[model samples]
Target: MNATDFIVSRNDLQQCKSIETQPPEAAALPADALLVKVTRFAFTANNITYAVMGDALKYWQLFPAPKDFGNIPVWGFGEVIASKHPNVAVGETLFGYFPMATHLVIEAADVTKRGLRDGAAHRQVAAPVYNAYARVSGDPAFTGKQGDYQALLRPLFMLSFLVDDFLAENDFYGARRVMLSSASSKTAYGLAHLLHRRDGIKVIGLTSAPNVAFVKSLGCYDEVVTYDAVTSLPADSPVAYVDMAGNSDLRERLHRHFGGQMKYSGRVGLTHRSTSPEEPELPGAKPSWFFAPDHIRKRAREWGPGGVDMRFGAAWAGFAPKLDQWLTVTEGRGPAAVQQVYLDTLNGRVPPDQGHILAL
Candidate 1:
């Protein structure tokens, strides 16, 4: 059968195309292999971060593409149409990392009641989180609108959960206030929600003027300020900066404005992709990249087996319900709609309150 894939240029994310190719025949499946038919996936600014940091984070390595193009990884659901693996059935559904294509073939390993890992040789070196797939039938989070919310915000919220844990684990780096840039983004606001519940630490959201009302509506941030009004924030108080926008100019401005008062700076996303790659020497804490998988591994060692999952699940139970009131899910199908949504997300045209689920 012909598989359609949407690929983007490695050098220019704006340059993308949908191409048709042949997938492996179901009858000729290798031992312990499963052919998953891609159904739908969520696309957000976070996916754009995967593209922007594809090389640095090895995202491009997950799915092979042409020499100059890449198949961006996304979190979504798929059905096992054909399986040579004895433990996995043909009709089972899965939730995990997938390419922007119609199908995927995974060499299933570590089969269990919960899920299995894609033990394909090429994917061995990628982060373990991206390599794992969960069985939808056994997952409690698969019911109701949970699947859509999971597709849209679970991954981002995981990062938010980790960031909040990381900060609290360090006693907020001796800061009384925590500031988040790109405050309107899902990840940022998710972090804000967690931090807002904490005592003594005020959550401040730095956003664009147009998004001030939306950010304020979340009721998670203590103070919402526009980019131009960043100087209005008191520089005397110790603060931790969690950056989601990755705007170099804004980074420099905040660093200069806060100077020694900037206790910790964690870079998480690149919602603004045109920023400079070189970060000049600044006065405040040096900007550091926050890789969620690294933190997950760290927590696993400190918390023992399934401890992270237990804590995350509890947090998600409380947080997931709030999203229904905050997000409006919009569905898109086929190549044209997918391409348009991709472009809209890439150009920052999608609203912060809307979640996009697309099928190719």
Candidate 2:
């Protein structure tokens, strides 16, 4: 098999590189491993977020790459072409976090009705949520129908759903208005869609002028305003700020404007990759990075085992059907096509409503 890997410069992520490797026979795969032939995955700003925070989150440690290069993690569907594990058979499909490569060998363990976690030695310290792969045949969200939608939104929307639930559970930190930066972002929209339905609080979307119309069309936010218009919002009202854009200046502006009324600041993503590294504080509650795993663990304790799955699955069912109204799935095949999609996402060249389904 000739498998290709997409690598990005640690210094300049905008520059991408690909390496193709030829493997021996399938019989050469390790006795306890499964070789997955990656089928499809979504390449979005979320993947950029992973690249940007790779070191901090230790994502780069998951699938090691050569010096000066990083292998960005992605969520996708893959079929096991060769396996030596007793429980996992060849031909079974799995969906979970995977590197942007044509093939991966998973040291499978903890096999269950749901799926098995990749027990690769390097992954022992990684978050369990990303380690577990679900068999599509058994996964209610991806079974047979709607597999495209699942591949596109499941990873991101799950984070959005969890973030919304976390904020709601905490009563939006006593704020009557919820402000989301990067409203055009898929994760931002998913949360906005949920908050828009909540009573009392207003869901406000902050986006660039170019994306203002697109964000407005989602109808997920009660109000849509460009970053230039952020000052138009009242300063005295209690507000919960969700910083999905991760631009330092934008965050500081919101902080300086809202002052103490900015009830909570959650630093989520850096879609604006040029965002300043040094934080300039003005006035507000301290911004906390929203690590999805921590929140997921807390909720699991409060809601019981599999509680998240039950709630997210129900919400996903309802939201999945409505995707056609907002998103377009575009298929890109082979290594070259996949490379272009990766570049498009890194350079923020992809359209707001288009979801790239990369196949290899």
Candidate 3:
């Protein structure tokens, strides 16, 4: 069998190139290894965050990349074509983080009935979220589901689930109104939907004027405000900002407008990748980086395993069904399509309503 891998520029992080070669044989494997046939995966702004922050967060270190080149990480489904481990078997459908390639060789450790964590030497210190992989067949949510939702939207929604839980856990930092930049983004919208379901606080969607209509149509936000309309928001009322776009200029304008009334600001993603300006002094709350894994671990400890599940499960039950109403899932296959769509997402050209699932 043969394999293909895509590596992008590590220094500039601009371009991606593909390489094809013979895949590793399963005849002789490590004592405990699982050879997964990469089936399909999702790519969106979320995946772009991995590449942009690869060096800072060590995304490049997770699945090894060639010198001066890096592989982008994605969440997707794979099948275990061969396993040398006693616990795992061939033909098992699994879900986890994977590089854009034909197959991945995982050294499985901390094996469980549901699945196992990738125990590759390089991954030991990485976040457990990426290290963990699930046996989809054993899970009810994915048992009979197609690759559409799970591949693309589910991962983003998970972050949304965490952000919503995090904000509520902290009582939205004493603000009754929440403003979400890049509100049209899947993660932002997912969070907005969860926020809308709760009482007391108002969920306001902030996006570009062109996207305002689409963001409004999602029916998640209580108010839809365009980026140009930042000053229009009430200065008298306090608000918390959940930032997804990572645009510094907009942050400054927001801080200037809301001033001391801006109770909290949480930075979530960098959908606008190249525009990080120095954080200038501002009157509002300082923008804090919202790392989803930290919150996930925190809640898992605070709520216990099942208790955490119950909270997110109850939220997902209310939000998942409404997804089909707004999202139109599409697939991009082969190396050419993968590369093109990667550029599209990185450039922020992909429309909010079209969800992309890639098979390479």
Residue-wise C-alpha lDDT for candidate 1, range 25-112, written one tens digit per residue: 9989899999999988999999999999899888898899999999999999999999999999998999999999999999999999
- Please report, as a residue range, the 10-residue window in candidate 3 with the lowest summed lDDT: 138-147
Cα lDDT tens digits for candidate 3, 72-180: 8889988999899998989998899998888898999989887799888898767888888988766667643345677677778889998888888889889999999
Off by over 4 Å in 2: 138-140, 143-145
Clashes of 3: 0
Q: Residue 313 CA error for candidate 1 (Å)? A: 0.2
| lDDT of all predictions | 0.93, 0.86, 0.86
Candidates in descending TM-score order: 1, 3, 2
TM-score of each: 0.98, 0.96, 0.96
> What is the lDDT, from 0 to 100, of the residue 246 in candidate 2?
88
Show model 1 residue runs off by greater than 4 Å.
138-140
lDDT of 3 at 122: 90
Error of 2 at 216 (Å): 1.2
Clashing pairs in 3: none
- lDDT of the structure predicted as candidate 3: 0.86
